[model samples]
Target: MPLLPGAEPYHRRGGPVGVLLCHGFTGAPQALRPWAEHLADAGLTVSVPLLPGHGTRWQDLRVTRWEDWYAELSRELLLLTEECERVFVAGLSMGGGLALRLAAEHGDRIAGVVVVNPSVRSDNPASVLLPVLRHLIPSRPGVVGDIARPDAVEIGYDRYPLNAAWSLARLWREIQRALPRVDQPLLLLRSPRDHVVSPANSALVLARISSIDVTERLCERSFHVATLDHDAELIFEETLEFVRRLAPDAKADDHQG
Candidate 1:
């Protein structure tokens, strides 16, 4: 995994209900910044950690794998768990996958989860052929949001990284295995125009989670990375509502007895 970005201000907020934001593969924390700010404004601490080999050259991604990504996210999540009484996990693309893993492995510890176009499956016809085709494909790099990257890089790479996809495939399998163990409230967001993972992946999450406290929404404006797209605001608003409904201050009977 590549080095993580500075999570300083986020660490400084200090609170009970913290929100951890994970960026996607070849993507940086820029995509999650808006969401983080919104949550922070609501008095909830937010942390948007850059995944390994991301927010840098695409070549760095070649040496990283899914496990590396999970380790880093887990570290950040554990830290939040220590400082905050309750925590929620949110991520875009591959970061979304990591968030799912975090919730699955630490279900009892997390308050809830928000997944935006999580990339558990590539759905690319190429990866299924030889299984290793993902590891063999070369990808340039990609980012989310038409809203301009913080680092000022284009969104989505032209080239496809075969090895990276292979790692993602493995990661997806792990999430699948971990699904049965997860029972937290979830907000799943998907874009109809997304070219990455198939919608079926979202269905898998809805069906496998041991609990039914899950809600899935389709982003009308976004493509793959709903973070920076047209529906980003809606994603943020709905996510906030979900979080509020689950907050400690919220009445348990607000939605039901």
Candidate 2:
């Protein structure tokens, strides 16, 4: 399938510290491109994979499930582990849940985790009817471009695929169940005024995760797509700092020496 412009996955090789970025449901790598580039520019290797069924059309997503997305991310993590001494995972929205799952299942391999407005559960009451609704309707209006800055745009499908959404909900439940296994450092950034995801989602994750080093920060001016909103620079810089603190690149240190 031909990927939409700007939706192609991004990869850059840099120092011994690698970071893998995951975009949200219905979202392409474009949503997290700037953040990935920021880390890469700071001498950190980064990979932002376009999840299966994304970066093409909404119809494609309907045929895919959460496991496909998680599997792709897991593959990327394995590749990073092979090339770098330390690996960190980060994601936005549903991608955040995937990152958390990676930390939960591969805590020993992942150096740390960072999530922005991660969604483990939907705030929509209608989501409960998804299993049935998916059989009746194919899609609904999209939940993209929720940014505080008017000019910022998130590149994604204009419609929400019901079947895929149901699968995402299932992924959330799995993440919640495995939260106790996530013992690596966690940095969660949320938007208090997010219209797409509720504040309670982040609260639930912070309370459930077993990580002793957990930090929660607020993007006061951004919305759900905080990566492209007013606080985008904050997200980029904070994640870079988080990675540096957790896993300093030995290559850089040797160069300094």
Per-residue lDDT for 1-257 in model 1, tens only? 32334322243363467788888776667667767877776677678766676655566766788888889888988888887777899888777878888998887788998998877765766657536555445653443344322433333333436577667778888988888877898999998877765787787778788867888898966677677777778888888798888886422213321
Q: How close is candidate 2 to the true structure, as a TM-score?
A: 0.96
lDDT of 2 by residue, 1-257 (tens): 89999999999888888999999988999989889888888888899999999998999998999999999999999999999999999999999989999999997899999999999987889989989999999899999889889888899999988999899989989999988899999999999999988988898899899999988889999999999999999999888788878876633632321
Candidate 1 CA-lDDT value: 0.72
User: Candidate 1 at residue 88, lDDT?
Assistant: 90
Q: Tell me the lDDT of candidate 2.
A: 0.90
Q: Which number leads on TM-score?
A: 2
- Our tally of clashes for model 2 stands at 0
For model 2 the local lDDT of residue 228 reads 95
